[model samples]
Target: MSDQSLLRERWLPGVRELSFGGDYNPEQWPREVWAQDLDLMRRAGVNLVSIGIFSWGLLEPRPGEFDFGWLDEVIEGLHAAGIRVDLGTPTTVPPQWFWQQNPHVRPVMRDGTVLAPGSRGICCPSSPEYAEASLRITTQLAERYGKHPAVALWHVHNEYGAPVSECYCEVSAAAFRAWLQARYGTLDALNTAWGTTFWGQTYGDWSQVGAPAQSASMSNPAHRLDFARFSSDELLGCFTRERDVLHEMSPGVPVTTNFMATNCPSMDLWKWSREVDVVANDHYLTAADPRSQVGLALDADLTRSLADGRPWMLMEHSSSAVNWQPRNLAKRPGELARNSLSHLARGADAILFFQWRASRRGAEKFHSAMLPHAGENSRVFREVTELGATLWSLTDVLSSRVQAPVAILWDWESLWAQDLDWRPSVDLEPRRQVREYYERLWHDKVTVDFAHPTADLSRYAVVLAPASYLLTGEAAANLTAYVEAGGHLVVGPFSGVVDQDDAVHPGGWNGVLRDLLQVSVEEVLPLPENAGVTLTGGTRAGVWAEDLAPQDAETVLEYTDGPAAGRPAVTRRALGGGTATYVSTVLDHHALTAVLDPVLERAGVTIDRDLPWDLEIVSRHGADGSEYVFAINHAGAPVDLPVEGVDLLTGEPCTGSTKIPAGAVRVFRR
Candidate 1:
C-alpha cells in the first residue's frame, strides 16, 4: 500500500482532520429532520458529508426493490454526529424504475434528441443497459457500505461528464464502433485517421462508423476529434466500472469521482486522474465573472495539478450565490472566506460542500448550502461556522504540498483539439487561452502547476504553453527536452499547430515546435470582430495573427497594426541555456505583463513584485520544513501581507507586515 499508505487510506482514513460537510439529503428531511440535520451538522463545523448523491428515487423504490431504511437512518445519524461519510454511488440519479426499465438508456443528443429522463446526468455512457444497471447499483453500494462506520469515502458517480457527455446512441453507435476497433487497428487505420479522404467520408464498414452524429456540414475534424476521444473513454468506462466495484466491495474503501474541473468540458481529467481514490473538485462562482476569484485560483491550480501535488479534495463549493447562473450572485461578505481560503491555498486537504441542508425541495433548490435558508441563523451558517473553526485549525495542513515554480501546459487532448469547429479564431478559446495565462500568473503572486505536456518538466522554472493546439510528437520531444534542459518555454498562439491526429503539422506552422520554436508559421492571421493589433512593443494584439518567419528567432514582438503588417509579433528562441518564447497574438493583461517581465527575469522566477493586484499569495510546504502562508484579500480595502508567521486566521502575530482586511482571509504559520 504506500503511495503514502494509499494517500492516507484514501483521504485521511483515521482523520488528520479538515473534511467539512455538505450534500446530505437525509431523504430530503423528515425523521425529525434527521436530528435537526445532526444539530446543524454539529453547529456548522461539519465533517465530511456527501451522502447518497441524488438518492436514486429514494434508494430503489421498485425494480428489484431495496431501501436501506432511509439510508440506514442516515448512516446511523452521521455516525452519531462526529460526522464523516462521502458515501454517494446513487449512480447520478438512475431510479425512475431504472428509467422505466431502460428506455434505450437515455442520452443521445448530437442533434439526435432522445434525452428525457428527469435530469441529473441521465445514463448512457455507452449503455449496455448502462453497464448492467450501473454495476448493480455499484455492487449494492459496495456490499452495503463496505464495513460502514460512517463510510469515510467512496462517492463514485456524481459529476462524470456532466448532464450527459456524448451519447448519439445506436448504443452509442455500437460503442463508437467498438472504440474505433480498439483505436484504429485498421478500417485502413480508421480511414487514415479520419481524414476520410477529404469528406467523401470513407468508412467501408465498421458499420459506416458514426456518433459525430447529425452533421450535414461540419463533422470530421478528425471525426470530431475521435468523438472527443470516444466520449472521454465512454465516461471513463463509467468510472472504471464503478471504480472496479468499489474496489471489490470495499476492501479498503477510498473510491471518489467528483471533478467538474474546468467545469466539465467532458471528462479526460488527464484520463480521469488515474481512476480516482482522491482528487476531488467542484468549484462554482462564475457569478458574472468579475474574475470569479480568478476562476477560483484556476480551479484550485487545476485540482492541485490533478493530485500530483497531492492534498486534493475541495469536493464541491458555494456557501452562497449559485443557483445556476445568469444572475445568481451572492457570496459577498468575505466571499465565503475568500472562496474557502482559495481552496485551502491551492492544495485543498478537503473542504466539501454542495449542500448540507438548505434544499427544501429539488432541482438543487437554490444551490448554495452549508445550512442556509436562514437556518443556523444564517450568513451561510456563520461563514460555515467560521470555515469550520478555520478547518479545525489546519491540522498542520495535513500532508502539505503546493509549491510551484510555474508550469501550465494542461492538455485534455490539447483542449479537445482546440475546441474543434473551424479554429483560427472564433476567439480561439483554449479555455480562454489557459485563462489568459492563468490570470497572468494569478496576478503575479505566481504559483501555478498544471503540467501534462508529456509530464515531468524537470520541476518547472517557467513553462507556460497557454493554449497548445495539439502538439504531440511525444509532446514535441518532451518540450525539446525542456528546452534542452534549461526550461523557460512559453509558446501561446495557435501553438505547435496540430498533430496527434487533428492533422496539419507536416512542415509548416510550428511543425512540432520548429526546432524548439525558432519560428515558422507563415499564415494564420485571425482578428476581425471589433478588431485590434499594434505590437512592436506597443503591444495591443487581439484574437490572433501569425505570418512569423524568423528562422533563427529573436524578434520578440513586431506586427504594428493588424494582419501581420510588419510580421513577427513575438519570438525568442535561444535554446541550450533555455528560452523558446513564441506568442503570435492575443496579449492584453498589460500585454501579458510586458511579455512575462523579461521572461520572469530570465527564469529566476520569483515574483510578489510588491503583490496586491487584490492580494493573493499561496505557499504550503510542510513535510516538516513548515511554511503555510495563504493571504487572499480580494479587495475593497486593506491589504499589506508581506508574511512572517502565526496568524492561522487570527491567533494573530504576523509581523514582517500583514494587515489583510476587507474580504479577509489570512492563514500564515510560516
Candidate 2:
C-alpha cells in the first residue's frame, strides 16, 4: 500500500471527520456518572476517547488476578454512544502490589537513590519482572477487547522514558553491557570507540563496563551517551513486547503510543516513530513564557515531519491551562480554537485534549479540561463546542498533506553531545539555536519541515543545520553531497567541531565541513553575557563570535567594531550548482531575518504574502487535487490578511484583503 493509504488506515480509518476527545477516566467517577459523560461527549461532538491509561491497579488488584468487569461496562457504554476507543495497555503506572512484591523493579537514579512508587513510570525498563507483569496485563486486556466493535487502536504505554529515563541499578548496568557487546563484538573495539585509552580507563572484561554513575568528577561523555541510548532502547523494548502481544491477539487493529512534544530527552522519537503504527503526540503550551502559541505550532510541525508529513493525531493538550507549570494561566477567549486549529493546519487529522472531564482531586485537579470544574456553563466548554463544529466543517481537508520547501536538521546525537560540560558557551544550546532559526522563518511566514541528518534532501530547497556538534563521517558526507548536488546548505556556529565519540577533529574547529563552506575558524571569542556587535549591514551578533576567514568563500557580513573587528561574521560560497552559507555567531532576530531573506529568495521559497508577526498561514494539498489555506490570527488586535479565496467555513468569497479578528481562524478553499 502507499504511504498515504497507510496513514489513513492507521489514523483515519472509519472516521469520516477529524477524531476528537481525549483521556476519558470513567474509573475516576462512579457508574452513574458514566451516562452523564456520554451525553456530554455527544453534545460536545467527541467521537473517540483514550481509556485505561493508568488503571493497572484497578484492573489487576492482586498478583496473577484480573478483573475486567468495570472496564467491560465502560467500553459497552461508550460503544453504545457511538464513541470509538483507544484502549491503553495500562503499563506506564505499575500497580502498587506488583511494586511492593518486586521492589527491585523500581528505578534507581544516577545518584543511587531509588524512586518512590507514588508517581507514574516508576518501574525500571530493564527489569524482566516488570516486563512480565506488564505483558500479562496487556494480553488479558487485548484478548478480552480485541473483537469489540469499539476498539480502534491500542495505546501501548503512556509517555515512555519521561522521569525514569535512566536507571543506575545493577540490572541496567548488565543491560548496558549487553547492548554494548551487541554493538561492538570485542573489548578492543569498544575501548577504541569510547576513547578509553585517553583517561586510562580501558576495560579488560565486559563485567568491568558499567553505566556511568556519580563520581567525584565528570564521567566519560561517550559512556553517558551510550547509556542514554540504551535506556531509550530498553523502554522501546518494553513497548514492543506489549505491542506484540496486542497484535497477536487482535488482528488488524493499529497500535500507537502518545509522544510528548520535544520534551522527551531520553527516547529518540525519530527511531520510535517507525515502531508504532501511527504517530500521536501530547502538547501543552509554555504558559510561563507567554509567547504566542507559535511554539506549540513548532511542536506539531515537528511531530508531523516525524511521521513523514502525513496526518497524525494530537492526542493530548490542555483546553486552557496545565497544572504542572510554575504558573498555570487560563487561555483567553479565542486562544483555545487558535491553538487547536494551528495543529490541524500543520498536518494533524485529530485534535484532542488531555482529558474529557475535570478531576475532582488529584495532582492535576486544576488542569483544565473540556468539561471544566464549573461544568457546561463555563467559557472553556462553550469554546470547546464551537471548535468542534468548526473542525467538523473541514472534513474535506482530511488526508491532505503539507508541502514544505525548507527543512531543519534535528540530530539526537548532536543534542546529547551539545549538553555535555566544557562547551564554548553555555548559551549555545542546540534547541535554542534551532528555535532561533525556526522563529525567524515563522515570522517570515515560511513553512518548514524538520529532517534528520540522514533524511533525503532531494525535495527540500534549503536545509538549515544548527549546532551540528557531533558530526559522524557519514553525516558529514551526507551534508556535503547535498550541497554539491545543488542544494542550499546553511551551517550554524559551533558545527562540525566534534565527531560521534565526543572527540574534536584534528585540525581547527568545524574542520569536517570546512571545504563545503569554504571557511575556517581561527579562534572562538566568547562574548560577555550582554555584549553584542554589529556588522556592516547593521546586523547584530551576540552570545558568541568566531574569528573566521574565507578560504574560497566571500564574506557576506563583517563585524564593524568589537574586539574582533574586521572579522567575518557570515560567509557564503557557491558550490557545484548551489550556495553554502556559514554563520559564525548567534544572530539576533533582525540579523537572522537579514541573513535568511536573501537565501530564501535565491531558493525560490514562497511566503504567500508578507504577514504580520501575529498572523500565520499554512496550506495543505488534498488527495483529490484541492487546495486548503488555514489562516490564523494569534494577535490580540484585528489585522488585514492580503489573501483571498473561498471560505470553506462560510462558503463566502473573500476578495482583495480579508480582515481577521483576534485569535480567529479562516479556512479558505481555492
Candidate 3:
C-alpha cells in the first residue's frame, strides 16, 4: 500500500469526523455517576473517551494481585453508551504500595536527592524493577480489554518524563555507561568524541562515566549533552516496552502517548514519533506571558509536522483556565472554540481535554474541564457542547491535511547543545531564534511546516534552518542536496559550527555548509546587555554578531556598527539551480523581515499582504475535495477580511470585507 494509505490504516483506521472528548476518569467518581458522564458525553457529541490513564493503584492494589472488576464495568458502560475508548496503560504513576515495596524504584535528582513519591511520574525509567511492574500492568490491561469492541487506541504511559526526567541513581549511571559504550564502541573513541583531554577528565574504563550530575563546577558540555540524550532514550525505552506489550497482546490496536510542548528538554518527540502509531500532545497556555497564545498555535503546528501530515490527536488541553500556572486566568468567551478549532485547522483529527469533569479533590481540583465545578449550567459546559457540535458538523473535513510549501527545521540535539554552559551568549536559545522567524511568517500569512533537518525537502520550495548550531554529517548532506535541487534555503546564525558529538568542525564556520553558504567566519562578537549593532535598511541586530566574509556569495546585509563594523551580516549564494541565504546576526522583527521577505518572494511563496495584524489564516484541503479556510482573529479588536467565502460555521454566504469579532474564529469554505 502507499505510505499515505498505510498511515491512515495503521494509526487511525475508520475514524469518521473529528473525535471530540476528554479524559474520563470514572474511577474518581462513584459507579452511579458514570451513567451521567455518558449522558453528558452524548449531549456534547463526544464519541471517544480516554480512560484509565492513572489508575495503576486501583488496577493492582497490591503486588502479585490484580483487579479488573471495576474497570470492566467502566468500559462496558462506555461501550453501552456508544462511546469508543482509548485505553490507557496506567504506567505513568505506579501504585503507592509498589514503591513502598521497592524503594529502589524511586528516582534521584542531580543533587543526589531522592524524589519522594508525593506526585505523579516519579519512578526512575532506568530501573528494571519499575519497567517490570509497568510491563505487568500493561500486559494485564491489553489481555483484558485489547479485543473488546469498545477499545479504539492503546494509550501508553501518560506524559513520559514530566516531573522527573533524569535520574542520577546507580542504575541510571550504569545504563548511561552502557549506552555510551554502544554508541562509541571503545573508550578511546568516547574520549575523543567528548574532548576529555581538556579538563584532565579522561576515562580509561566505562565505569568511570556517570550521569552528569552535581558537578563542583560547570559540567562538561559533551557529558551533559550525552546525558540529556540518554535520559530521553531511557524514557523512550519505557514507552516502547509498554507499547510492545500492547502490540503483542492486541495486534491491531494502534498505540500512542501524549507529548508535551516542543520546548521541553526531557523527551525528544521527533524520535518518539517514529515509535508510535499516532502522535498525540497535551498543551496548556503560558499564563505568565499574555502574548503566548500565538506560541501555542506554533506548538500545534509543530505537532502536526511530527505526524507527517497524518491526522493526530490533541490529547489534552484545558477547557478554560489551568490551575498549575502562577495566576490561572480563565479563558474569555469564544477562547475555547478558537483554541479547539485552531488545532483542527493544523491537522488534528481529534480535540480532547485533560478531563471530562472537574476534580472534587486533588492537586488539579481547580483545573477546568468539560463539566466544571458549576455543573452543566455553566458557561464552560455551554462552550464545550457548542465546540462539539461544530466538530460533528465538519465530518467532511475529517482526514484532511494541512499543506505548506515552506518548511522550518527544528532539532532537539541542537537545542540541547546550543544553550549549554560557556557559550558565546546566554541568549543563544534555539527556540527563541526560530520563533523570531516563525512569528514573522505567521504575521505575513505564510503557511509553514516544521521539519527535521533530515526530512525530505523535495516537496517544499523554501526551507528555513534557524539556530542550527550542531549539524550531523547526514543532516548537513541532506540540506546541501536540497539547495542543489532548486530549493531555496535560509539558515540562521551559529549554524553548522559543531558536529553531532559537540565537537567543533575543523573547517571555518558553517562546517559542512561552508561551501554551500559561501561564507567563512573569522570571529564572533557577542553584544553585551542593552547593546546592539546598526545595519542597513534601518534594521538593528541585537545579542549576536559574527565577523563574516563572503567567498563565492554576495553580501546582502552589512553590519555598519559594533566591533564587526562593515562586515557581512547576511550573505547569499546561488549554486546548481538553487540559492542559500545565511543570516549572521540576531535580527529584531523588522530586521528579520528585511532579510526574509526577499527570500520568500524569490521562492514564490504566497503571503496575504493585506492580512490584518490581529488576524491569522490557515487553509486545509478536505478529503471530499473541498477547501477550508480558518480566519482566526487573535486580537482584542475585530478584524475585517476583504475576501469572499461561505462561512462554514453559520452556513451564510460571506462576501468581500467580512468583520470577525475579537477572539472569534470564522471557518470559511471556498
What is the C-alpha lDDT profile of model 3 across 154-265, one tens digit per residue? Answer: 8998888787889999999999999998899999999998999988999988888989989889888998999999999999999999887888888777889999856466
TM-score of 1: 0.41
Query: For each candidate, what is the lDDT?
Result: 0.81, 0.87, 0.87
Each prediction's TM-score against the native? 0.41, 0.98, 0.97
List runs of model 2 lying over 4 Å from the truth. Answer: 1-10
Residue pairs in clash, model 2: none
- TM-score-wise, the better of 1 and 2 is 2
RMSD of candidates 1 onward, in order: 18.4, 1.6, 1.8
Better of 1 and 3 by lDDT: 3
User: In every candidate, how many clashes are there?
Assistant: 3, 0, 0
Global lDDT for candidate 2? Answer: 0.87
Instruction: Give candidate 2's error at residue 219 in angstroms.
Output: 1.0
Q: Give a tens-digit lDDT track for model 1, residues 558-642.
A: 8877777878788898888888898878888888888888988899987766767878888899878989888888888997766
Better of 2 and 3 by TM-score: 2
Prediction 1 global C-alpha lDDT? 0.81
Native-to-model Cα distance after best TM-score fit, residue 583 in candidate 2, in Å: 0.1
Clashing pairs in 3: none
lDDT of 2 by residue, 240-342 (tens): 8998788778877888899885878778889988888889999888887656476887898899988888789999998998998888888999889999999
